[model samples]
Target: MDQRVTIEIIDGVADVRLVRADKMNALDNAMFDGLVEAGETLKLNKQVRCVVLSGEGRAFCAGLDASNFGRMAGGGGGGEPENATSRLGPRTHGISNRAQYAVWVWRELEVPVIAAVHGFAYGGGFQLMLGADMRYVTPDARLSILEIKWGLVPDMAGTQLMRHLVREDLVRELTYTGRIFSGAEAQQMGFATRVCDDPRAEALKVAREIAGKSPDAIRAAKRIYNAANYRSAADGLMDESIEQSSLIGSPNQVEAVKANLEQRAPRFAD
Candidate 1:
């Protein structure tokens, strides 16, 4: 709903874009709010079976806006802080503050969220990519943990998200140094799902493929995978069984089977 972010859904894939090309889609409070709002809106829409997230301009995102850097250190006097009175410790959006929710919302979405990153995804922007279930990046795109450059930490759920993607030592090294790395290195390092010459086009292709599946199965898979990271093997196994139990013989599942047998496209209900 916010102007900083926009959402458009077709078929079953939600195309979410960060549209602040002038600032390289940098994060300010408004950008964070916009992102969270879009995510929440889509979360309630059963028709949205997948999401393709990308930024509009030369870069996907450049991290926290440069101006905010001064204010975070308690110095910049010109602009208002993203709400000076709101301390970040509060769980404003179901286990995250508003800014954290900007990234975490992707994880919370029931369907898979894919990121198409190009140019540079720095500091907060890099963490933002981590939020996506899969990241398709340009081989030459720049990425970094980035907070260490300002003597700060990646507070936007970066610490929690990176641990699942890369090794602890690699995470520590990146967070400590804030050095930039190319997307090609990111794929090898486990940060990117794929490095491509045109990440957006590839991301959309993958998204469309996912969208064609049974939404019930896709959402269940997302839930199962999201819980698998922290839960025990037994619980994960039970989760798989529970989800399968619900899907068995369901209309969408039946349609899936019928479509395959008939050699026709499935018409799944939302």
Candidate 2:
């Protein structure tokens, strides 16, 4: 994994931190690659029960390196144009093109992900946080759908994710206007799960608590919640059936019950 992103595990919680403090953890190609690599790491990590995603230094993320705008507009640096080449298949993840997958990888992870945001989460950065299962933001954190400022759209799966979290009209208003809002307003608008004095600390606390539970149950819960948004009521019900069928009578599921009954740690199999 790149040094720009750091993954450290304490017990079962993987603490993933974006370490580009010098640039407020801006989304350069390297940062994007690092984030995706981190997500991929979690996919095969059996011991990881949950992940706490936060940033080093003051801000969570400052969004697309403001300089990327120059590159996108056919200027130097910032690398090639995002749409310069068109490959096949799902670009990184659903809705997000490969250029936007830096943030979308979080959504693909089977385990729950919590984003702890503070300072600025603007444009691409704000969209990045949307990929997390829950967002715990500092009350003073600044967030926005700022792509409009550059005469662009939220192309990072922001539209798809926001529809599930906020009202359709509100999503339109925010995306169209590119207005900046505080975390307090975000919580009310349904973008933030909660606002706190220290969002990272609160998010880590929640992650640790979740890590103490049955991993199978948590995975099932995530699948159910994800399906609820993508599928119809009937299909969602069937999804529950399919997911539960795989979990039922499984070694981990049985160990969960045994641990609960014995009031001891679950010796779950990988």
Candidate 3:
């Protein structure tokens, strides 16, 4: 069988691809292991400054495999009695719990990750994109919060990520209806950062730019931004103040200023 995931490291950027193109990169046991292993590998790879995530072939992902659904249905939405999935991967609201982790792991990455999406990203696939720091989608790509159609809800990390990107009613509408929308529509709705003909190219263009900057500052900024999403305004302000104070006199930060003044490249430590 073909590898379900592939990771390539070049110039401090980890390029990750979901390689199961034949199945539209759908989530299955092997794919789950691949994604988790990828995320875990990245956690220890200090050389990595940025990550670009995308899928191979026609679509980014088509969600879970039909065979997974068949097993769930046959086992009453549970897993085989001897499997770990049996205890932790119940199919709740059309999405097995394990499937949700496929997306959630990206959010746990310390460095920034950009998801480059094309073609169709439906159901769990849509939620998978949500885990990234930013998403660049093809203009003609099709996206949907499609769990409702399968008699389910967005059980993955959708509920958490959608809270900031979409209005309450809009989230409700999409989740309740399982409506498919174009990438341009997703951009308008705040689910996508931009829509382009070549999403992967655009995402890499941006990731390279980020990789060229001060890694410490960039990571600090990501932390602040991520915190703001779930924090109160007063708490957010405090965090901003603390983060700024911490950065002002740091060695790497001083290097940032000196590099600009001396017109030399700054070498940052991980």
Candidate 4:
């Protein structure tokens, strides 16, 4: 995890960075483990009110590491080769397999997560970005649903997340062709929340702003929003009330109101 990903938490926000810069922060076995571990850590840490995810160096991620392809071609590689078929039957982390959990865990977090993407986000990396609640990207960054180029379907929760973001026809087109698109196009197509000159800085700014809110309320908001796509309207409405009831008059909630009335920043407890 240390070799591939790094985490730093400050003032209720966690900055999670992909550190394998030399290979464009590609998703190797270590990277997969690191991402999953980071997500799990943040999920259990109530002090983390928001998260910003980004990669070091020129690209966000170039999808699977090239060595994995070499291994598939019967060449020598750094680590043991993975058996794709062997992963299909079991739910390694509740509803996801090892690969899928590397991406899906971010979505499972109660606090908001923002992905700051630059350069290339392809194949598995593209799916990884989808796990975040919002994405801030560079206008010139390249993105693609690239698994088709290697004759494989997206197996890391891409199919599930894409439906919530883009039109059916567009998703089908991208999946079938493996064509690249710019981040500006991604925003227009609903894949990105915004395109910025420096995505990481912008994402950090937004994360800090979120961190200033009542932690309980922020978490409840994420839960309510996440439920919109998966739950029936009746269930969603009931959950909204239940969540709100839990937050109303809570210590953090009272602090938020007091701070607003006093014109000062709220001092919230985790």
The number of clashing residue pairs in each candidate reads 0, 0, 0, 0
Give the Cα error of residue 64 in candidate 3, in Å: 0.8
TM-score of 3: 0.78
- Could you tell me the lDDT of residue 21 within candidate 3? 91
lDDT string for model 4 (13-77, tens) is 99999999999999988999999999999999989999999999999999988666544333121
Global CA lDDT computed for model 3: 0.75
Q: Rank the candidates by lDDT, best first.
A: 4, 1, 2, 3
Identify the superior model by lDDT, candidate 1 or candidate 3: 1
Please report the candidate that would top lDDT against the real structure: 4
* Residues 1-270 of candidate 1: C-alpha lDDT, one tens digit per residue: 457999889989899999999999999878988988898899999999899999999999999887664443333221433333334444677666677788888988999999999998999899899899999999999999876555455777777777788999999999878789999999999999998999988988999999999989999998998887634433332332334334434456555545544568868789
Question: Candidate 2, which segments miss by more than 4 Å at Cα?
Answer: 75-96, 231-270
Over the stretch 112-225, how does candidate 3's per-residue lDDT look in tens digits?
999999988998789889889999999889999986554445655677778889888999999878889999999999999988899998888888888888888878887888
Error of 3 at 250 (Å): 56
Tens digits of per-residue lDDT for model 2 on 89-191? Answer: 2333544455456666787688889999999999888988998999999888999998655545566667667878999999999987988999999999999
Better of 2 and 3 by TM-score: 2
TM-score per candidate: 0.81, 0.80, 0.78, 0.82
**lDDT value, candidate 2, whole model:** 0.77
Q: Which clashing pairs does model 3 show?
A: none
